[model samples]
Target chain A: MQTLHNGKLTRSVSLEDRGWSLGEALFETLLVQQGNPVWLEEHLARLARGCERLQFDFPERALRDDIHQLLSESRDDRAVLRLCLSGDSLGVRGYGAVSRTPHRYCQLAALAPPVRQYWDEGIRAFVAKTRLPEQVELAGIKHSNRLPHVLARAERKARDFPEGLMLSASGLVVEGIASNCFIAVNGELKTPLLDRAGVEGIVRQKVIEVLRTQGVTISEARLTLSDIEAADELFFCNSLIGLWPARQLDCLSFSSFSLCQRVQKELESVWYV
Target chain B: MQTLHNGKLTRSVSLEDRGWSLGEALFETLLVQQGNPVWLEEHLARLARGCERLQFDFPERALRDDIHQLLSESRDDRAVLRLCLSGDSLGVRGYGAVSRTPHRYCQLAALAPPVRQYWDEGIRAFVAKTRLPEQVELAGIKHSNRLPHVLARAERKARDFPEGLMLSASGLVVEGIASNCFIAVNGELKTPLLDRAGVEGIVRQKVIEVLRTQGVTISEARLTLSDIEAADELFFCNSLIGLWPARQLDCLSFSSFSLCQRVQKELESVWYV
Candidate 1:
């Protein structure tokens, strides 16, 4: 529960006074490893990009310096550092809130390895009755307005499913609740184009880059339930989980040996191995 | 900026410590009139409903009593009161934030009001390029996750229009960014049925109730862009701005004397008269 604003500790401030009520805040959650944040620069860059999108003035150097200082003081090798940028009439600046009890804030109870574990074996997914709004302006940026995802997550949670696929009102497949979706169709990696909606996840971007370097052809295209059902393999990707294979969806199940192994190995090389 | 937790003032609390971050918080915003909040009971009822939706424990009696006590200390007759509910292992309770400088917080700038004034006269609104996700579980409730509206608002703002109309990907018109939409077509008043992907706004509900009492025939139907384009009149409604007429959208414009007079009279009877 340690709080710092502009690299200085503050106490007993009103959340609104601190500008939380104005919805004038942008936040970054970075994974801390070996007492240092992994991909720190990338996270900062994304934070800067988010600030630009919101027209919030970003204090980049100050934030970077503060993180460096805080990491230097911390003893834990792995933790999560949350950087919140609250907008002020003066400008946007960074504040830090760290988990005093790391386990409660950073560690989540591991689920039954997700239904995707059975994807290589066979997993079942269904088109969630949910629809996503097509909003181009906020399409690729991740901001605090996440009620739709929250709703979607609740539905998925209630159904006891690892992930739920969302469709736009137009019946175009968008992405999973918390991950970007991809399908290996006829030996090519295809994901839904995010020009209209969905967050442009950093992990998804990195995975795409890695896949490209490995000579895998990837394309962003409009996908539908039919397209997914016709694919050889289906998977979802996120920073924390890397890759999850989908086996069964609704009543259609696809089991592909080569495609699943290739993606699993590729993600392992980038995340674990 | 004064804050109260369960009617008691406190400083520096964490979502984890208070369990507020667990998504258990329910909030309500009421317009204060001469230091008294307008339709306070209605806002409280909405908050109660939100709590029920989230299955959080709420002490309604205590909260209402506290609000009454706090209102007595108000200096301005007209202000805004925000009530937030949080929970912990202990139980669920409420928090209040009252505006001290009510005038400063209450003034509305004439900054390009959403769409052009001509649209205010009566305009045609097309379905936005983006669609809303239909999640029945979270469809009509107002919770903290508001990213969908944020995206919609940004999209509308980018279009440089007073407002953008959103449709559920299923082709049903839902709502505007921060307002509810209604249409008068073929001698009948129609609005989107909110059983799927829109909020049940207090203002909207109030307007509908008043209209019903006046023996005006209003029906909740799944509407489409074509239906709107063919309508004789269109307007957006919200609590802050009672009813705003749309004059021109995209290329269509309608100036219906009967419709405009009816809406004006409705507002006059509700507020001005």
Candidate 2:
């Protein structure tokens, strides 16, 4: 594993030698292909944004160089690189790398192809009985406090559903466990604005950008269950899977929508591997 | 650095490895004293509860034995032990020691204390403008998904306040960052129950038990900012620092009441210092 701290590579023998033990770190996961990371700038931007939200210094230029160097040296055509910034007596900064492989447990068991199939066809989703606590200060940035996602995902898995939708305590729809939910209403695409909750997923941003360029009006607004249920089409988006069309939601299904197919085709044409 | 898996100690190097990169782990932090972890049962219960919440297997016996052995050999009279459980190919358990010392940092050079003498004499507090998201499943467990606390604490620190009084998105007061809040209202002490959106802190539980045994009536209820502002006394409690008296909050200040002093003395008398 290649590790970096404050923009310099180190042969540290112990994870403890870094300030990460204090849980003062933020990270990013990137997809590297052919010894080059895809969407490298976007991933780095998100990482820097996370650091900004956490009030930590981000060495963007140094990080870019390090990521480029590591990707150049890695032999695997496809791999996953993780960048972590940890805080200690010195300050907040740390990074690490990993060659992507299907592990028997987390990477494999925790993530199944059946789950990914939601990206191809669509998914049946249900609103979680639980509501996300509303903290405006923490609404959008992803900072590793993921118990809510874990719990919500467990609930969804128990119900035998592909994905679970969550709502803020104020009764406004937020997003999914690991993806952002979007709906097409009156020919315009709308998703829950992350002004209050949910992560500003990289894929979601890309989709919005792609759609905007296609003359498709996209908006961020507070959505409710009723809105989702009445929409012309529904889908979820995240960095890894790009986009997943929603086939059904608690007693409601929209598998036959032409718009869903159109949007899926358009997104996949650009994003699908 | 004592480690155990499935309740037995083996020289298996796999057990000592950190597999957190795969994201299949849950952990708990507990205070240990004089060869015995304080509230040991409660901590384990929470860990098991978190595992249940996340649908992960809880290695109860092994975890307990590991803690038991570590505390027995430690030289420090008090220490913080962190137990991590990960679902990986190698195995799913690990233990590590955490620093007892608190690390304090400032955003723009720590602002002057919000209320002078509150550090020593305690201070009154007001409900923050922010509200915690309502995720009932994750409401009361201490999980690694602590981004909320980190964000809340940052906001609180930026405001030059020692604490941020959080409310649920539904406008119900919850608790503070890393602390449980309580107030003496209408001649009776009351705290917000942890059924919905806060950690069921071991220290909070112990204080409630102690107060109940002393014939001091304590009720777990939804407390409003009005209730707190109107209360005859206010204080915050946690495991690390027994109880801190609040002196001033926003525009309100209450004289140091004798009830707070009496409770402080009673608590200090039995505190594990």
Second chain alone, TM-score for each candidate: 0.76, 0.74
lDDT of 2: 0.60
CA lDDT of B104 in candidate 1? 8
TM-score attained by model 2: 0.77
Q: Give the alpha-carbon lDDT of every model.
A: 0.59, 0.60
Which candidate should be chosen as best, given DockQ against the real structure? 2
> Residues A12-50, candidate 2, lDDT per residue (tens digit)?
312232222223345565555455565768877876787
Off by over 4 Å in 1: A1-3, A10-14, A17-26, A86-131, A156-162, A246-273, B10-13, B17-26, B34-36, B52-59, B85-137, B145-177, B181-188, B222-236, B243-273
Query: For model 2, what is the alpha-carbon lDDT of residue A227?
Result: 93
How accurate locally is residue B145 in candidate 1, as Cα lDDT from 0 to 100? 47
lDDT of 1 at B80: 54
Per residue, candidate 1 scores C-alpha lDDT tens digits across A1-273 of 344556675433235322233333455566565666656677778777777765556677777777776777777644556676643322111121111111111111111222344434544556677576666655776554444454465454423466678887567888887678888877788889987777777766776776788788999999988898789988776655566677766677767745556666765643442
- RMSD to the native, candidate 2? 7.9
The weakest ten consecutive residues by lDDT in model 2 chain B span B102-111
Model 2 misplaced stretches (Cα beyond 4 Å): A1-25, A89-120, A156-162, A260-273, B1-29, B84-120, B123-130, B155-164
